[model samples]
Target: MSLRVGVIGGGQLARMMVPAAVNLGIDLRVLAEAEGSPAQLAATAVGDYRDLATVLEFAKTVDVITFDHEHVPEEILRELVSAGHSVHPGPDALRFAQDKLAMRRRLSELGVPVPDWAEVRSEDELAAFLEDHDGHAVLKTARGGYDGKGVRLIRDVGESTDWFRILDEDGRGGSLLVEELVDFRRELAQLVARRPSGETRLWPVVETVQRHGVCSEVFAPAPGTTSRLVDLAASIAVTIAESLDVTGVLAVELFETTDDRLLVNELAMRPHNSGHWSIEGSVTSQFEQHLRAVLDLPLGDTATRAPWTVMVNVLGGPSAGDLTDAYPKALADQPNVKVHNYGKEPRPGRKIGHVTATGDELDEAAFEARSVAALLGSDISIAP
Candidate 1:
């Protein structure tokens, strides 16, 4: 019998995993809230990821369960584990991704480099944090925030009061975590995969560009960054995965401080936006590696296939028409570019797909990727 894998959340991640599952001969299924979700195209089932009954029922047919997002409730995950259902990146490891405060505290305990942070329950607490951090700080909800949502920059105590009230009134507020905003040179990401057997692999660190909290582009090896820095970031990713007992793929987002230090910024237990470049750049794409790790199979090679590669996210723009029209134009312009569309309905600011280009030179590949992305309507210029 073929090993069956059930995935929670039928987003683009799960959609991309389908090809990997096919390549590995594993039966892939997804639990989604509705029909026609990205992953539902290949999933064995479509249902609510948060509904225990749906999830449990879905789990019964799969050998192991994994996730596309961290939004699944911890209680439900624990219940699934307790019931003898194998869940990779289990609840213990997932909690850190689900709650920023929990992640910050644990990273601190592990002696990982991270910004100074504190949990705040009220404006008074926010004020104390701000005073200590130089009157400016980032405030984030402990849970459920993503892609620029649930995050605020407070310049003073008054803003903190407004934030506290606004978040509380929204009924989605959880504990708040405030941190000193670092003057970072750039953001980087380290991608790693771990198996239940304790085997692990790390990919080359990449630089990420974010616009409005959404990752817009990624450049592998992060121009001008030394091999030493890449090794350091990879080590940090492996350490966090081992410490958290995480199985499957994990992404550690980092901030390269002005003083030349790397600080942990965020964690994702599933295949992350940062690793999307691996699809065309690495011998083993993060999606494939994730499935391998979860199934306890031997991990694949993570070495880059080329000296440099670039991935650009295609965010829906204001053109308000079918973006597919640009595809033929893009392919005509750059035939070597690999484009992956999520099959999602276009909406302003939503991620619809990504384009990746690989070449011997970093700048050339980045230009190709950026040119394709610009055809999709991004204002960012491709640096030649």
Candidate 2:
């Protein structure tokens, strides 16, 4: 019998999973909030994921429930689980992805390498942390922060006073975390997948470039990285998945310091932006691996298919014309480049699609990926 999988959140991640599900002969369905959502083009239901009635209805038609985002409420997830619906990366495991403070506390207890952080409940606590950490720090909301929102870099104690006041006035003062600003050499991401049976697999560590808290590009097997560093990242990813009892994919974003140490920066329980290059770079794409894991099928190979693979995100810019107009030019110039658009309406700084290119030489692949992204109106520089 073909396995049925129901995914929550109707975004590009779910859109990408469709092809993988089709290839694996799995029946894929999406729970979307509205018509024309990226995944709605193929989803089986249209409703709010937070509504228990809606979720239960969708779950009734599928053998397993998964996610494209971690925004779904834990209570709703618990309800589904109680009803005997199989949810991969279950509610217990997803809480860490939804709340940063909880995740940091748990990882610290697990002996994972993480930045020094403290939960600040008032201006006094914020001041103390800043004083101890060189008078500069990064503050973030414990929940609902992404793409640079709900995050602030405070270089002055006076500036942070207003931020603390705003949170306190809104009764959300307790949902905040402050951490020292570490000067890191670069950002890295380790992607791994776990099966319900406890089997696990890992992909090569990739370098991620972020612009204003949003991912701009990714490089597989991060250039000039040593085998030792790769092993370190893979070990951390595997250990976290096993410790969390995660049943699907998990991405551990890391910070590589000048001292060659790795520090966990963030956790994502589903296919992440950092893993987008795997669609064409790895022997088995992350989307495919996620489907296999959720369905309790045997996992696939995680080897890289080329020496270098690059993925460039296409952020919407101020272009009046339809973005598709650039496709003809991009394909004519670089036929080998693979483009995946999320079918979203263009908005300033929004992620619309991405382009991937692979080659024996890193420079060539990076050039191809950037060229296509530029044609789509992204303003990022491609490194040679």
Candidate 3:
């Protein structure tokens, strides 16, 4: 019998994994949130991920259980382990990804460099944190924040009074996280894969560009990066993966500060947006590597397929019509570029798809990617 892997959550990440599973002869099963989710092609069960019976029932069908996202409740995951089900990047490591304050505290204990942070429960506590950070700080909800949501830049304590009030009303009564606003030159990401047996592999660090807090572009190997910087980034990712006992793919979002210091900004324990370029750029795509890692199979080559690869997201696709409307012109315009539609309907600022271009020159690759992104209804203007 072929090995079966059950994935929780039915987003684009799981959708992307289907092709990899087919190529490797692995049976992929998905417990999608809805009937027409992006991963519906592989979806075998449609139900609520938070409902214990639904999840446990799905778990019985696969040899190992993984996730498309990290929002699954901790208690449910523990129950799976207790019942002898295999879960990659298990609950202990997942908690850090789910809660920012917990992540900061644990990273601090590991001597991982992160932004100065404090957990504040009230307006006065928030005020104190702001006062020390030159009256400006980034406030974040410990959970449920992603792609520019649940985070705010505040110059005064009153700016977060509503958040504090909301927390007060919550029976959980959680404290918000406040961190020193980082002065960074640019954002970077390191992608690594580890198996249950403890062997790990890392890809070249890449540069990420964010627009309105959503990742819009990624430049593989991060143009102009020094060898020392690349080694340093690799070391940091490997350390975190081993220390946390993380399995499957781990994406480490980083800040390359102006003074040349590298600081840990965030962590993602599965296939992430920054590594999307790997689909056509790496010898082994992150999707494929994730499957191998989670199944305890030997990893594959991570070498880049070209000298440069640029990925640009298709944000809020087609101003007035379906994505298919623009495909004719987009494909003809940049025949060399690869377009991946996530089968999602367009909405303002939503990631409907992405485009990638690989070449021997960075300028040409970036130009092709940005050109296709605009033609596909992404809001970004191609740089002249």
Candidate 4:
């Protein structure tokens, strides 16, 4: 009998995993939030992931459960475990990814390098943090934030009045996460996969370019990373995964500081946007690796397929119509580039798809990827 893996949250991550599951012969099932979700191809059920009855019914069909995103309630996840269902990157490990404030405290306890941060409960607290950080800081809600949403740059306490109000409205009276603005030279991501048996593998750290807080492009192996920097990044990811007892893919977003230090920026306990290039760039894509790790199967080699691979996100599809409308021009403009459309309608700053190119030179690969991405009407410019 084939191994069954049920995924919660049917977004593009779940959609991308479908092809990997097919090749591996694992039965992939998704519990999508709604009809016509990106992962509709493999969606076997549709309902609220937070609903116990809905999720319990879906859990019965799969041998193991994983996630496409981290928004599922922790109580539901723990309940699944209590009922004897296997949930990879189990609730304990997932808590760090779900709540940024919790993540910082835990990472600090683990002696992980991270920016100075605090859980600020009021305007005075935020003001104090800002004053100490050169009058600038990044404020984030503890939960439900991603893709630059639920995040803000603040130099004054007044800027966070609304967030404070929202916190006040919550009966529990939560605190906001405030961090010293990192003086980073460039952003880097390290992708690693850890199986239930504790075996782990890491891909080369990659450089990511963000526009308007959304990932715009990636260059595999992070151009100009010395061997020492590469090793350090890998070490950090491995340490975190093992420390947290994380199962399945873990993406560690990092800040390469101007002082040559690497600090943890954020964590994602599932296949992440940064590793999307691996689909065509590496021998084992993150999507495939995620399934393998969660199933406790032997992981695949993570070596790069080319010397340089570039991934450019199709941030926004054509203003006039669907992504397919630009396919003719996009496909022909860069024949060698690979495009993965999320099958979504165009909207400003939405990630509808991504294009990747692998070649001997970074410049050539980036150009091909960018050219195709531009033709597809990415909101960002093609110029490097």
lDDT of all predictions, in order shown? Answer: 0.88, 0.89, 0.93, 0.95
Ranking by lDDT: 4, 3, 2, 1
Minimal lDDT window, size 10, model 3: 375-384
What is the TM-score of each predicted model, taking all chains together? 0.96, 0.97, 0.98, 0.99
Candidate 1 at residue 260, lDDT?
Answer: 90
- Model 4 clashing-pair count: 0
**Model 2 C-alpha lDDT per residue in residues 1-384, reported as the tens digit of each score:** 778999998999999999998887888999988899999766889989879999999999999999999999999999999999999989999999999999999999999999999988877788899999989999988888888887899977677676677777898446579988878999999999999998899999999999978999899979989999989999999989999888889999999998899999999999999999999999999999999998888999999999999999988842776568777887788899998888887787899899999999998998988988887777553453
Across residues 12-119, which tens digit of lDDT does each residue of candidate 3 receive? 999999999999999999999999999999999999989989999999999999999999999999999999999998999898898989999988999988999999
Q: Output the number of the lDDT-best candidate.
A: 4
RMSDs, each prediction? 1.9, 1.5, 1.0, 0.8
Against the true structure, candidate 4 reaches a TM-score of 0.99
Better of 2 and 3 by lDDT: 3
**Model 2 scores what on Cα lDDT?**
0.89
TM-score of 2: 0.97
Rank list by TM-score:
4, 3, 2, 1
Give the Cα error of residue 13 in candidate 2, in Å: 0.2
The residue pairs in collision within model 2 are none
> Native-vs-model 3 lDDT?
0.93
Stretches of model 4 off by over 4 angstroms after superposition: none
On the 0 to 100 scale, the lDDT of residue 11 in model 2 is: 96
Model 4 alpha-carbon miss at residue 14, Å: 0.4
